[model samples]
Target: MQYKLITIEGNIGAGKTTLAKILSERLHGRLILESFEDNPFLPKFYKEPEKYSFPLELFFMAERFKQLQHSVNGPDLFHDTTISDYVFIKSLLFAKVTLAEDEYKLYKRLFHIINKQLPNPDILIYLHVPIQKLQKNIQTRDRSYEQSIPDEYLQKIQNTYLEYLKQSDQKVLFVEAENADFLTDSKHVDLILDALSKDYSPGKHYLQLS
Candidate 1:
């Protein structure tokens, strides 16, 4: 199948961005990356989650909505190929883990409204990695705001991703990132593109990294 829109989703340090960039270049698709650096509430929420979770989630929800809207309005609409580093649905996964009960309720209401207006991706690539690998990657990347991310938080995010994939009807491609070197391996990149080209059946689609 030829997907006009492709979304890459994963927990922090799962290498979604790297794959998205490579795929976009390989496939000649436009790339839409999540604006994590510009998110003012992210660092604050990471530091004091209880106090800042609601605002942070809301901000992300709004931004993601706008980004999707822009994607729909762009020339990519006619180009037949686009890749994004973050999927809009992943917003709720983070919210579920980060927000308090009341905050989550409110976030859900807003999320439904925003989600109803956004365009769904023709294909979603979910990257999975072990908590230890995620921790190691985060440390190596040295993103200051991410330095304090707890193992439990990464675990929750990973679990939430799996649950979301199980319940979702969208065409999904699950990739295990434990040993994939997407940045340097052409064969690995080709394997991913081939997986995306295939039918979206349930279950993991393992691609050997050369």
Candidate 2:
């Protein structure tokens, strides 16, 4: 109620997309899900990250920019609020983990330039699940490429995301999801709704299942 655009984000397999979908339906908001299944570099990147990391991230950044620019900037008469499963800054966070230092530096420059053209979320709910929980969820989803994702990689990504969350200037609900499942738990949904109903200064706000 206090936000015009709500973003659901987290490490891989944290169920952000499911949460975003549920919130969009409940709020009668426009849902913008990242369409990554078609990316040619994704599977290759997982198998050979050293060789494909740059291309993988580059393609993702381009696609995310194009998608968000179109979806967020367009007029939507039917829905007053917009719910997205990702925040644009995740691109930088992820690239920091996967790219070489020089590549990341260059990518960061491009990201800053492209990001200026997109609007930030009014509130971003970052679901923080343990690496083991995230691994289990990733396995359950059964994406062949993601099945082989090492725990070390997941840990790096989690660390990067946490660092960014701590320094973020935007309103963020830092939520722990190790004990909750947004798809099967009604309480989890209520928790998200309650978090979004209040206003907060631009900074991190901690949340949990309870």
Candidate 3:
């Protein structure tokens, strides 16, 4: 792998973890998967977003900071390529959509403080899936908390991610992934692998594996 770190991100059920696992195994790279299941607030958040949004986001921000410090930011082999299913910025993106305006201001302040001390991904791969497809995937997964996630919420989060990524200075791969399936299709993995193997100028790069 050419990049030291690669991050795959998308809406709730966009298969970020699946692709991260595939690339990690194929390249023998270090993998950092998001532990969303372990969060105690997630279930309550979906059931009552207004009541739980702030704490849910706060919990995630802390967990992500600690996890990254333990894994990607560890005192390990500098040669090892690290792949993560989500980035630190994800906390902020989700917060923007879920938190109250005052709560979000505080969240962003905390986020920027933690973010500056962490390492940015060499490349951020955004798997672009439509809201309809995302909802289908969410339902197929059968997560009780995720079952009620409204399409409007997903759309807001998606828009937040796109806006931030578009203006970012880091290298980003915008994969039009409405039809891409890394788990079932080898070519889909190949397309991502190809992107990982080459270096790109810092900007948005588009791909459609068809």
- Per-prediction TM-score: 0.93, 0.98, 0.97
What does candidate 1's lDDT look like per residue over 1-210, in tens digits? 388888888889989999999988888878898887878988888888898888888888888889878885566444468899998888899999988888888888888887887788887888778899899989989989999999999999889989888888877787777887887767877888888778766555555443
As for lDDT, the candidate ahead, 2 or 3, is 2
The per-residue C-alpha lDDT of model 3 at residue 166 equals: 79
Model 3 scores a C-alpha lDDT of 0.90
Error at 105, model 2, angstroms: 1.5
lDDT of each: 0.83, 0.92, 0.90
Please write out the lDDT profile of model 2 over residues 89-185, one tens digit for every residue: 9899899999999999999999999999999999999999999999999999999989989999999999998888888899999998888787788
| For model 2, the run of ten residues with the poorest summed lDDT | 177-186
What does each candidate score in C-alpha RMSD? 1.8, 0.9, 1.2
Taking the tens digit of each residue's C-alpha lDDT, what string does model 3 give over 88-159? 999999999999999999999899988988998999999999999999999998988788888899999899
Q: Which ten-residue region of model 1 has the weakest summed lDDT?
A: 201-210
* Candidate closer to the true structure by lDDT (higher is better), 1 or 2: 2
Q: How many clashes does each candidate structure show, in the order listed? A: 0, 0, 0
